[model samples]
Target: MATLQDYRNERLRKLAALRELGVDPYPAHAERTHTCAEVVEKFDELIGQTVSVAGRIVSIRSFGKLAFIKLRDASGDVQLYLQKDDVAGLDASRGVLGMKQLKLLDTGDFVQATGEMVVTKTGEKSVGVHELRLLTKSLRPMPEKLDNKEERFRRRYVDMNVNPEVRQRFIRRSKFWQATRDYLNQHGFTEVNVPVLEHTTGGADANPFVTHMDALDDQQFYLRISHELPLKRLIGAGFEKVYDLGPRFRNENYSDEHLPEHIAMEWYAAYWDWRQGMRFMENMYKDVLQKTFGTLHFRLGEFEVDMSGKWDVWDYAEVIAQHYGIDVYHTTIDEVAAKLKEHSLEVEKTDSIPRGIDKLWKNIRKSVAGPVWLVNTPKFISPLSKANPDNPQSVERFQPIIAGSELGNGFSELNDPIDQLNRFVEQQRMRDAGDDEAMMLDIDYVEMLEYGMPPACGWGWSERVFWIFEGVTAREGVPFPQLRHEIDEVTKAIYSEAELQ
Candidate 1:
């Protein structure tokens, strides 16, 4: 039962041994002609040709005068065959420094190999090494396996090293956002970067993380909870089509689907309504999904959703009536709260009437396995959306629902300054009434609307799309997620009772 320090000490001895034998344990540079994947893919063309490859040594096997090392690079893995005779002719300066140098190399160390491609008798494609150079000497040994979720998240670098699938998932996540940007760029959308710090945060119902800026006369600022307000400001500035994709912060509860900080994308298009927005959004989803995952079908949780076919549309009021037996337009806040309590659903006492109804809808939404569009939202629940002309009580809002959650939100933008001001004022009242998640009254945004913004459509979605499609929690999809600091046993033992006093 050796401690980690003991293992480290042994590796340190090897480091010293390498230095004594005129081998640099850590070199500044190494030659690499091909990646592991390229070497494997072009094996037939490259056979008998000397090529250089570099990677971390994942595994090693020794048989008296020969050794087999499994090398892993970013692209893929390849086998390297080392023989006592091959190393004698590698370098004239370090003449015939044979098996001793190879024995010093360990797993987790990065090494570069110059070798000729050959197939083993057992049919494994490998490189026969004539030269080997240590690129980096790893001081700490990697864990045999990373099984604990918290540990894996805390040490994502190690987790990714041990788990190839985890690495692939992040690769796909990059492709997902890239595909989104490509689709928007093709549609003539100008990508604009908005300020992350704001005096008044609005555009979505969420508690904001606040900080004070010393440079700005000690004024308090909030991290932008949503990209809505600033992107719309661009629309008022006469940008017909604008979009932003970046990080946003919200001081709210953490769940399988939620994170305190996450990447969000929002876009606004002038002279377009919610119907046109929906059509564009559907196509965007299809294109991005195909580009990233290479298929329309995804297994998210227990549901298998297919985005290739036509998506179904459901009215918000009708959905609530059918699922919860409560008409969203007709039900009182108190009555809805009572119904939620009857079903043992949790409700916050400080929530506004609209928030209460929203919570009820969310509970019902869990049963909906859909690539469905939920439309005709009640005006109170969607203050930023334009009111439907035919039905003033409802707003022209649509949400893409998938696997029991709202995947994204879109609506016909409410550009009338007077109406927008009134809605902001109402929302402010809710904030004053103790609903911390209520949207703030952004007077600047209202003033921007006074300058006359064109009728537009807006939509937004977060990286939760990646999480849903990959069938992972929000924490898993993200490379590094926030976690509470844990006091290790050593730290606890270091702090004595006398120090506390």
Candidate 2:
């Protein structure tokens, strides 16, 4: 069995041989008149006409005087036919390789083929090559199969090549975000990119990743845990309809639905309440989902979700009371903790009444297969939401429950500085009492609130939405997930002379 290093060494020797022959093995340019897919799709019209195609060589077969190469580009793959008598000789200046030089090419090498469309005797659509040019020479061949989770993530580029479905998943991921932007833009929302680093991060109950800014007197700054505060700050700055789509960092452990860092989008519409926001999101969800997946219905895990129909509205307080027998408005910390323990949930010493009740709610949420809006959450649990006028204990907050998880959150923006300050102070007290996930008090944001932002409704959701609908884990959904740095023994041995550890 030849090891990877042995195969690499063999390629290296071939690279040297090509160099010695004055052939440019790694050329800077190649010509492509059509994609592999186009060659096949337009075959009837393109028949007998010379066309240039470039792609990675996926396969090669030779029978004495004749050979075939399967070239694969992003669009698709096509076959190239070659005959020793008809092909041109090597041209070092143009980087063209004759039929005799095909022995130097490998399966993973990139090449351009200029040929006339034809059908083989066996009736396979292919290109009859007159000229072949080397574009790139791959030293390390891609693995035939990449199924190990650890290796797949570590070498994602190789995983994408070996498993094309992984590549297609990311294409859909791009579509998901593009659909979001399309819907938001169609609704007249102006996208403004906000700062990724903040002096005080306070949007959510998640510990933030900290960093030092040498340009700003070496002050300690935080990687933003949410885009909510800064985007809302734009609302205070007189932006009527605003949104941002970018990465946010959260210093936390991973879960199936959560990553320490992920892309999220938040939008705010001035003068809109939670109810209006709810309606807007329903349409946006339908539009985005239909555009990305081409359907409004999804089978996510064991639950079936249909975004086309009217979504049910569930009162947060009522759901908690009915499921766990605890009034969210009047629940005691001890009572919440006891219920948490009875339900086999996490009961931490730092768990406040709000946190404990939330855990109990999530337990019930696990069974709900819904496109449901969970509204009227307690004011204490929603620090940035406006308090409901009808019920002061509850805030005008709304969350979309889908496939047993909260996919999105929205709130009637709280613009009252005094109320926001009090909530911040309360959250600070929780932090002092050993709750590391409590929101930090951002006085600057409070000052902006004092300056008076308009009545608005704000909503945000992470790429977890795409992950959920796409039926992939947090790590799998991302092209490259963060992993602890490590050098394998094989890699270290390969680079031993370069002082690799």
Candidate 3:
């Protein structure tokens, strides 16, 4: 393998060549009046015009006796036809450019170019080179352009230069988020930020990541798994409509479907019901699909999901009855447990069979495809939801499931203080009984409910939306993904006994 020393050797040679030409290979700065993109955009207006432009060299077509090069900046790419007879900078760094020279210029190298735009005989966009300046030298080699690979597209900053489709996806990703914010604003939802750190807490199930602070002799909290608990307090304080679209941290399993820290869009509207939440979720995504991709059909793995179609609503208990021929309200817990065992599912004797049924639904969710409102969930599984008025058995909650996994959890938020406290106490018992995923009894959240917060439906969904709508796995969407056993250099330094102690 070519090593970093080999890179230093080649770059030193370039430095020597530039020194011989009396030019600094690494200059402090370059002044330019136009970007490669702006020149091309205003081409008709700047025809025969001398424009000062700056960009990194992207493509070079050399005619040994002469050369043609393309330079790119964030705005766009511009081509340069450098005829050796008129060129000023070729003598020092001379060669048939290797994909490796792309290494020398670096696929990611920053550069500046001064040129005039002109169309070649083939009527292709091209620039006549007058001058070139190096910004930052790139030493790393990029994937071969003609390889037409899939992974390079996932490392999409590199692919954006070579693949038009990859570039367009990112462009759409940008617009997709912008459109969501615009929609939220139009609906009178005020954006609010919640503290990631907590002392005494309330939120969804799952263990929190523990962090310590020596100076205060306190264990400083790391961050939250979800934004639900804090946002609810804002609801209690009378913010009628609120939303938070940001990153949430969870210490959990790693899979194509999960990331430890991920983006989520949580929204709460006062005086709303589970039905209202359903309408908003269904309509919000359909509009986002239209605004982003201009269509509702998204290729989810091998299957196609139509977002614009009717969202089939399924009751949790009814679906369980339909799927397993067992109902918790009508059947004994032991019978539910027995049916699950008949289906080859197992659970600790301490766990209720409804918990086993919950597991089955998650497994079956993978086979399901589309926008589905999975409602009327079991009370044992959803601690934050209100028990149904009619059934009193299942909670009034549902998740928007798409492509098998839940897009998010939503419900008619439980605001009755007595019932909420009882649920919290039950949760504490579950935690004491060795279920670490059980939530702690958050007395404050219950206290706030006693103050009479309005009956509002709140939904918290982490942005597995990118995974669902964009047709990629959850881990595939995050930029810097967490690796299970990888020890990064910077982290190692911080974790060293001398530093940590």
The prediction achieving the highest lDDT against the true structure is: 2
Q: On residues 1-501, what C-alpha lDDT tens digit does candidate 3 reach at each position?
A: 865457556766765654665555566767788878878788898777777776666665665655666677767787776655544544334222222222245444566655677787767666665665566665444445734444452355666665555556567767777888888899899999887777655577767777766766877765677788788889999999998888777778877777778777788888999988888878888887799878888888856788877899888877777878877567677776777677777656666555677766775677788678888888888888988988788888979888887887888988899998999999898889887678888888888889988988887766567666777666545544565344445445644665532
lDDT of 2 at 475: 100
Index of the highest-TM-score prediction: 2
Q: How big is the RMSD of model 2? A: 0.9
CA-lDDT, candidates in order: 0.89, 0.92, 0.72
Model 1 over residues 1-501: C-alpha lDDT tens digits? 976667777888988877776666666667899999999999999999999999999998988688899999999999998887875432414322355566777889998888899998789999998887778878778888999988898889999998879999999999999999999999999999999999999899899999999999999999999999999999999899999999999999899999999999999999999999999999999999999999998887789898998889999888778777887778787888887798888877786568777888888789777899999999999999999998899999999999998999999999999999999999898889888888899889999999889999999999998899888999998999999977556435445553432
Per-residue lDDT of 23-122 in model 2, one digit per residue for the tens? 8988777789999999999999999999999999999998868999999999999999998887888887777887777888889999999989999999
Compare candidates 1 and 2 on TM-score and give the better one.
Answer: 2
lDDT of 2 at 270: 95
TM-score of each: 0.94, 0.99, 0.85
Off by over 4 Å in 1: 21-23, 88-98, 490-501
- Candidate 3 residue 30 Cα shift, in angstroms, is 4.5
Determine which window of 10 residues in candidate 2 has minimal summed lDDT: 92-101
- Residue 452 in candidate 1, Cα distance off native in Å: 0.8
